[model samples]
Structures are given as C-alpha cells and as structure tokens.
Target: MASSSVAGEPKQSRPGFFKRSVQFFKDAWGELKRVRWPNRKELTSYTMVVMGTCIFIILLIFGFDLGISYVLELIGLR
Candidate 1:
C-alpha cells in the first residue's frame, strides 16, 4: 500500500492568527472600496423619507389606540 505523505516531507501548515487578521482587514478594505456610497444630497433625501414614513406610522397607531380607548370608555370597560 502507498501512503499520501512521503517519509521525510514537511506537511503544509495553516496560517497563524496574525496573518489571518491582516488578510481579513485587507478583504474588508477591498469590499469597502468597491461600494457605491450615497452622496450627501441622496443621504439627506433618504433620511427625510424614512422620517416621514415613521411619523405617518406613529400617527396612524396613535389614532387607532385613541379610537379603541374611547369606545372602551363608553362601554364601561375602562
């Protein structure tokens, strides 16, 4: 039977923690460079849209709660 490892050959070793950490940062920086970041104007527009949607949802929920409470109070449940 033949063996995979030769009698006197040195086996390959895995990368150490320091080398792996450096490689991780290198990969992260490469990905960041490829990203198409939004400009200031676009960021502002997006922020406004998110804020408006949140405010609308809050108001809708508040209206529902008030209506439910009013009905409950009238029926002596509150």
Candidate 2:
C-alpha cells in the first residue's frame, strides 16, 4: 500500500514559556474588555438577591435538621 503520510509538511513547535504567558494575558484582557460590567446599583441588587437566596436555603436546611433531630430523639436514638 502507498504511504498516506505527506513527507514535507512543516512541523510546528510549541511557543516559549514567556511568549505563552504574554499571549495568555493578552487573551484574558481582550475577554475582560468584551464583558458587560454591572453598574453599582445592579451589583448591589444582585448581591442582595444572592444573600437572600442563601439565607432562605440555610433556614430551610436548619428546619429540616431540627425536625429530623426531634424525630431521632423521640425514637430514643439520640
């Protein structure tokens, strides 16, 4: 069978560490610039929403744990 591989293809080498680092920072900065940054009011509102959700979830978990503990205690397991 004839060989399928080409003989004269140019081999690409890995970039040097310094070049790679510079390229990474350049790409990160470009991406950051493209992001739509939230304004202060929007940031505050989002923060409050996140905190509220977290508190609600914590309270829910606490309620479930308290109920389970009471049940366990009544059954003389604790």
Candidate 3:
C-alpha cells in the first residue's frame, strides 16, 4: 500500500508510522525563524502586566475569603 510520485516513481516504502516527522520539524523550525521575538523591554512590560493582574485577582480572592470567614464566625459556623 505504497504511494507513487507524480512521474510514476514509486514513493519510498518507509513504514507507515509518523510519516512526516522530519518535515514537520523542518517546517516548525522555518516558522520559528520568521518570528519577531519580543525585546527585553517589551518582555519586562508584559511580565509586569501579568504579575499585576495576578496580584489583583489574588487580593480579590483573599478579601472574599476573609469576608466569608467573618460572616461564618459571627453565625457560630466555626
């Protein structure tokens, strides 16, 4: 069950497993070369933004937890 080339050349009869691994890596590496990687300043800014957002969410969750605990304690729910 092998494929033939357009010129009637019998395709390489390699095993049916992972047919295009090398091709996939080559294509991926090519794409990686095309990427415009972020500069240090941009990376720092992005990281800071992400950190600030995480801190805000954590603070919000902490406040909610404290409020719920206080209410539960007042009702003798431990």
Q: Write the per-residue lDDT of candidate 2 for residues 20-77, one digit (tens) a residue.
A: 9999999999999999999999999999999999999999999999999999999999
TM-scores, in order shown? 0.69, 0.86, 0.71
**Please, what are the lDDT tens digits per residue for candidate 3 over residues 3-54?**
4566666667775557578778889999999999999999999999999999
Cα deviation of 2 in candidate 1 (Å)? 22
Ranking by lDDT: 1, 2, 3
**Candidate 1: C-alpha RMSD after superposition:** 5.5
- RMSD to true structure for each model, in Å: 5.5, 3.5, 5.7
| Candidate 2 Cα misplacement greater than 4 A, ranges | 1-8
Per-residue lDDT, model 3, residue 52, is 100
TM-score of 2: 0.86
Residue 39 lDDT, candidate 3, scale 0-100: 100
Candidate 1, residue 48: how far the Cα is off, in Å: 0.7
The alpha-carbon root-mean-square deviation between model 3 and the true structure, to one decimal in Å, is 5.7
Instruction: Give residue 24's error in model 2 in angstroms.
Output: 0.4
What is candidate 3's TM-score against the reference? 0.71
Q: What would you estimate as the lDDT of candidate 1?
A: 0.97
